[model samples]
Target: MRSLQPSRDVRIASASGAITDLPENLAELAKNANVDFIIGDWMSEYNMTTRGSQKVTNTDEAAFEQQFVDSLTVALPDLAKRKIKLAVNAGASDTKRLHNKTLELVKGAGLHLTVAWIEGDEVLDIVEACKKEGQRFRNITTGQFLSDWEYEPIYAQCYLGCFGIAEALKQGADIVVCGRVADAAPTMGAAAYWHGWSRNSYAQLAHSLIAGHLIECSYYVTGGNFTGFKSLPQSSDGTGLLNLPMARVREDGTFFIEAHEIPGRGGEVSVNTCRTQLLYELQGKRYYNSDVVAILDQIKIEEGDGRNSVYVYNVGFEKPPPTTKVGLTAFGGYQAEIHYFLVGLDIEEKAALLENQLRQYLKGNFSLLKFTTSGTSTSNPVSQDAATVDLRIFAQSKSRNDLSDANFLKPCFNMVMSTYPGATFAVDARQALPKPFNEYFVTILPQSLLNHTAHIPALDKSVRVDAPTDTVPYTFEQDIELTVDPIDLFSLGPTVIAPLGYVVHARSGDKGSDCNVGFYVRNEDEYPWLKSLLSIERIKELLQNDYNGKRIERFELPNICAVHFLLKDHLDRGVASSSTYDVLGKNVAEYLRAKHVQIPKKFLDRGRI
Candidate 1:
């Protein structure tokens, strides 16, 4: 591929296989449209660990920014002469290595470019600071940070203010790299800065988040997937990271987002595509419109001369909160399973018979839960498994526990060993088969990422893990201290096997992004008093305090069983759920830690943690 001069303001060419072959097509499109900046959205989470990609330094993470740099290196000469600026937002999780390498990439090519990190350390620092303050749990919108310890950005973007880009151009930066800015921000900032718009201009920001969302995907607004298959009219192209061309600059220091396609690409934009984009960015719990304002509800659309343009105004914007987001994934090893089918004149009796037979046949290696069969829609069930009351038993331990423990699973032959009258075995499938092990992805709010806040109180409460009782009203923090030695933390009062009350158990399945942590308990009884002490607040408190002030307390640890605690302060309805009632759940975790020093006096006369 050769670099060619498309205009005095911008250079148009293909990056060959470096960035992608699409650059040539982009060059043709940019030449057709009066465009200034050519942005390439590169990388996504899956791209991070794309296995053997040269662009990424860490094999676990995808190397997209490198790809972007390599692509630009090919056209550096042409880009330098035309004063065309290249921008990309691709290194959201890779830290500064990607950003620094990009600067070096351009420099090595004899080109000088300015770089901005929108995600990485910027958000990490903020999150850490916020956590130190009071941020807790993973937020669905605005606050949640990147997951996938190692990942590639699906849409890496500079999210530069439209005007800011214009200035960077003036500053003579040949290229710009960013993590995430508003999609339209780069374009808007470029336009606004070039047009000399003020930061306080509400009208301009409103245009930005709207235009960003519109063209952030680039061609989506340009008629890439604008297809109204059913209506066969003007529709939106559901293409990802499509370029939008309605980016218009006005003399009044303001701009308008363009919803048009390449000048002569022969595509159609309509109310359908425009509205679809609106609905597309509406992921997470709610849509986070950039740092601007616009009357999205009042958005008007019109198509003229084969061009569908959206007239947008009055958009509202908010500054993102400072906090670090942590994503955790619980991966599984292996699993073993067994299936049993029982038949009888009484369905319930047959199911119960199978339970008894397995209990005696395999001693006590299984649990019996009535197979819940409801919500059966579709032409057939999601899986091919037949029979309504099939016992789905599973086991992980290979010891005697796996074959005969009360908590373990039973063997397949157990079914035939005690088959009922009409319990004829159908298609003899793998009877004592195995269960597929899966991992769940969940986000954690660690103190380090939450702004590094540590606030510990006096440790006047203590208990032993071996000691047992019903009521303690002690507080528990989700503080799983690595320094305290898990055994001691539990032995102090009652180290819990599971946090009591409502403990959110999330696992990554088909459609889940991360294993979510939230409340699952319906009542307080499921958790014994001592088991009900764990809570997020208490964890935060212990993290903040770290056994500093309030007289040290103590507790005890359990041997074969995990001690569970019920939280009082930390566990609340989702803050967005509107049912939190301003009640801050803090006691659960605090009481557990408080018992760290005084529990022996309260429950055990001689126990000490």
Candidate 2:
């Protein structure tokens, strides 16, 4: 076995490709070395419900992700020979099945790696018992009680911490599998095990948590999904596919993030890339995980002297809350969508006519019907495709028969030829097929009730871990009053109206039903101007049509020259039930970037634009 490094410093790389990211991620891992641990986070909020549904039909392999096993099988021999430890939350609901399958693969490959799995993240029984005892699980987002839910939950799981994983590693396990822990829990567990840190090491834990968060999404920190991808320096290979990110964490909990220094790799690890990932999916200034609360308001990202690296520092933390978040998924009926194309002249009028016809013919069939036009009409069109606009009609109902493709398509097909001059169905019949929808409900469960345990297959033993009982009563700092220092428009010269993307970079994502958009500037001088320019009112004005008077919360991260805005209930009822065209809220930032905004001539003269 490879001996533990005496330096007490740990290097962890994420091979998490989750659903469709397996093959490429495994290839990246095989090409890199000097990594003490490999962590793969495969579960997402949406996948949990899908896995739960699968469990209902196929109990044998419902909880395990087959793609994770496939990737690990290919990498198992090398990892075993090198003694590199592995931890992953790929076992969505069933760690035992995944563990057994992995053991079979190891036996077949003639390897002796000790594997362990953690349990207690499945809390359906606990939730049901709590309900029986008159405990009404209040919805964290909607402020509604669980008793108000229309459907029965199929599965429920609580977010777990890393203590059980740490224990497994300490007991000589080479690989650890977990269920629905926090996305960053495996990384946190690996760091804690390497350095022997305790639950009370808030600062160290917080830093490690940040490190895990950065790498959890794999290539996200290495220019994947970055808005300013056009501005990032590219290598000679000329491909946008970036090397996955890895963090070299010190014993003191500070870490430098970088892509593998492989020759001809195409991405850079600059401050902008790191800062973009830091703000992704963030709810506010304070980011809460099961382990610690990271205060992102003061976090700093500095460029490193080394190529393709950035130093992350000053990540502040507070003690964790008394309870952790619990996510429950219930059947939410059915939904269906159909698409129509309106090409060339009079596209807007054609779309309006189509919606009017759809409403007249299909109004009573669906409980909720929405018509959205995708593409804008160009004033001076160069091609037919450029002038084409797609009108999408989406409907949802509790009755499966009402949402069936046969019933859903009747109205559209009936009026297709008679609708407009150049209107045609844009999608195939299969695209309009209705699918079962699931509702996501989140609440908090006391940490004490979680019976966390580490089960070692090699030793045939299981050990229970005590949850952290020390609760920290914490309140977020009051929102900073926006008093824009005011830029002298006369001295700055004329302002040019341009899309926000020309002058700034943004990253936005979903946190349940809420969406967060973080916008930042590269230079310090432009920050003050940006701060004053994009106030809550101005941001609302920019997103006026979509804002719909929803609660908008804004926070300033001056250290990073960034502002974060949270749009509550912005995604309807989150990704599972939301009828929005961009289900994951990934496009919110890009949409904002496309909005025309005023840029000062002096700032533009500096020439980063």
Candidate 3:
């Protein structure tokens, strides 16, 4: 059998956009000669919950994602002919089913391909045994015990590392299917397998891990979903759907990240775009992945020679964790929401009246009821749409009967005839129907408990991979205090009070229920002021309207002139169960940027602001 090119350099590309991203992009990825391997991340916290529910309602074969198969079918023939391997976590909860289906697709196309699947991330049995042994699966976000949940969990899985996938590839698999592994595990596994890196090659593994993290969201490292997106150079198409990102990784662990340079492709890759993704979902300086713990404080990014390219380097890593993180999803309850539009005069008064009516109608039926108003009504209305105010009310309860649309939405609809004139429903009435709320529980299981294995049907053999027995214990520590003195505003010549977006770029995301906001500046001189101005206290002040006295931790990445804040329990119950309008907290940083702040005139004078 032929092998990959002798060159130690490998180019890996990510085609999956988000957990719910379409797979059509894989067709474009297969045409690139520069790419040796392609990875698609098809699993997210919410995605896992949905897949788990599907598995419960149907057979294991129905648990696999068909979109992945459909997309792979479009690109499989091309990839096979080019000898480019594909890896994806689209298996969700059914790795074996996905593997078999992929094999059938390959064979049906008159192509002989080797397919492999990695498993053992599932821990339902372990969770059940732990429960029997009186072990409590505590909620990492709310600090509640699993026994407190209203419904038993449908599924439980742990985040595995890259070694299993690496082993599968080493056995000559053309494609690898994986269950719930770290989003970057496939990329790290490919790099390790290609370079024959030692399991303890902390530096190389860490670098590849960072690279995978950067491109895992496909074009996110490009201009997609970026706060500084307006600054990106436009393409001929004038659209922001930039070509997905691909990385040219060398054996030495250094890599150049850039998007496919097809003509008219949207999105731009630069230091700012890279910086935005580098801190996208980061919690603090210490980022934990199953493969290695990357110390992001010293990570650096620079412009690459290629068009719209950036180089990421200097990522440091420590030993792997002794236990892998486990995520368990339980049915919290039924949740229902209704949106009411209040247009015309006396908006505030109408809003108050509506809330009072809802409270009276839903006196004690729900465990949680929240009424939030969006789009303020101004004096002297210009237009009906402009004057319209949105009143969003959500309710959750342990009883499905309690959260039904009759109990939640009927009251609002019934009040429309009597309360505030011109009050009407803003969204489709179907949205008022109750839906299952999945509560997320995170914990850790010893490595020895998981039975990691890789199977190749062509060879009709399965290989059991042993967990690392020499894992090092982890010690928790408080965030490092800022040593640099705060900058004196008077030292600068003049200042202006404006939105902070003028001087800084920010990106925010959610990790379970915690919100991470990363803020960075373009000018090095402004770094001092940014660090001093956006302290923990100042951030809490800016978000004071939404602050709920939750724990917050701050960390600084001087190499990128950025500060990251982790807001614990800020997203309520996370995406699947959160009652907030912005469940992912993707707008947290944008909200901060819109806050009025004193900006140094010298920095703004550069005209880049």
Candidate 4:
């Protein structure tokens, strides 16, 4: 880590995280933001299944995200005019179609721009071949063998590294479209291409990877979904919460994040905002990517010198993981859910009565039947709305006919008159129709087995991007344990029974069926207390209803004063298939925060969170 020559400064601005995210802002950002590259992330575990479903069910329609195409239609002219290169994982399941569509857009606009695409992420054939060769492809979270998987997998996609993107950018491509590349690959690729970093530049590449991960979700790093969301400032128009994020990366791979300086843009980038994004969807301290494994325990976030800016640095790294992660999706079954509102008196009894009635009246043989009650009716009359809670009935079956309105909804509808006092269902008769769901399985495959390639249409050339030659087989057990001096809760003085959010900021996200919840404190002195209070057993108790003997993994980021827990199989089969109310696990932190905890009374003196 010696002082080296300064490299070209690259400013990468993200339009959005998903295809549906602020599509209108792309043209404005491209026209105004003085950025070198503009990128967007359109793929997620849920998105993979959805996009794959489109390709499978309808071959006539373009399988890629249409919102991205519409956004590009407006932004492409500005992008070409400004020479701001664009890169996005908008291809989803069908990258080539998106690439061709992009080429068509460029041609139709009467503009000349070289568009490139990275393929080989779709590996259904490879997966089938490997399965035939005795690769069990066990589910990473549940340890279930793939042979036992009920749904037949129609699509398999491996996460690609940034090298393919870097090659495309280096080969004079003005735009690059990718399918199932690692979410952070664009930023890492842009930085690597700009800085000419070598593949063996593990530390630097690792830092770039971290930078990409931070900004990959657009505004997530710039106060969006922040625990301090109430503190977000109002835009010039007096409306609040509209924000865009950009990363200014240096040659050293260190970067500062800031909200796009567009007039009327709201939100701020602070240490906490960056810290929250850093802790999101992470499993352990060492974050494994195709390019390099980022050691995140030592990474630090600080308030930058400029307004609404946060600087990040000190990210350590090792060689890349020998295997790259892959997501295989399959049609699980048809699922239908019904909700009923129970107002006032004996809510629990009413719920029980409804469940019993439905069980007796149900005619279908369901694979999964779940009853979820959300919210607690407040005691002592305020408003009738305040005295109401929702009881949801979720039913899943392999046969769609079994979950139709007649079989599933009729039984619940049958209880309308005979059930609890003041009973009413939430949905209309038509809304109760069953819909299909997809099961997502996350596993890893040796990088050597992948045929990662980049296709440059302008040059009529296809380049093979080889997997990392110098890779280390990484395991979570190899990560060094972080040591923190424990704080004695009894010695911290009188405790108050209150919500943990009083002195803590938390964020949670899903990875396949697993969910990660990270808790962090603002003051450095409170780190030990926060760490000591949230033990694995305490977490299980807090998430008593959700835990259900699920495996949990805990890790710490001392630099950010954060503790993160991974609840395995907490969301059942992930967003697409999970019948849970909080299937995405975005509310897990808020749920945990609402749980009453014995907090140091002194901390309560800091005032309401």
The number of clashing residue pairs in each candidate reads 141, 0, 1, 0
Candidate 2 local distance difference test against the native? 0.81
lDDT: the better of candidates 1 and 4 = 4
Give candidate 2 regions above 4 Å deviation: 1-8, 363-365, 473-493
Listed in order, each prediction's TM-score against the native is: 0.45, 0.95, 0.95, 0.97
lDDT of each: 0.36, 0.81, 0.82, 0.85
Looking at candidate 1, the ten consecutive residues that score lowest on lDDT are: 506-515
- Report how far off residue 543 is in candidate 3 (Å): 0.9
Encode model 3's per-residue lDDT on 1-609: one tens digit a residue.
122443767889898956567568888888764688999988888877777766766773467778888899899888988998988988888888889899989989999889999989889899899899998766655567778876677789888889888888888899999978899998998888888876778898889999998989887888888877776667777664576788878786788897777678667778998899888888688777766788888899998876777888999888887778788877777888889998877878988998898898874368788888888777787887788888988888888888665677676788888888887875587778888778777767767778888888798768887777656654333374563578786687788888888879999998888889999999788888888887888888999799889777888888889988888889987888889889989999888898998887888787643
RMSD of 4: 2.1
Return the top candidate by TM-score.
Answer: 4
Per lDDT, the best of the predicted structures is: 4
Query: Model 3 residue 520 lDDT?
Result: 96
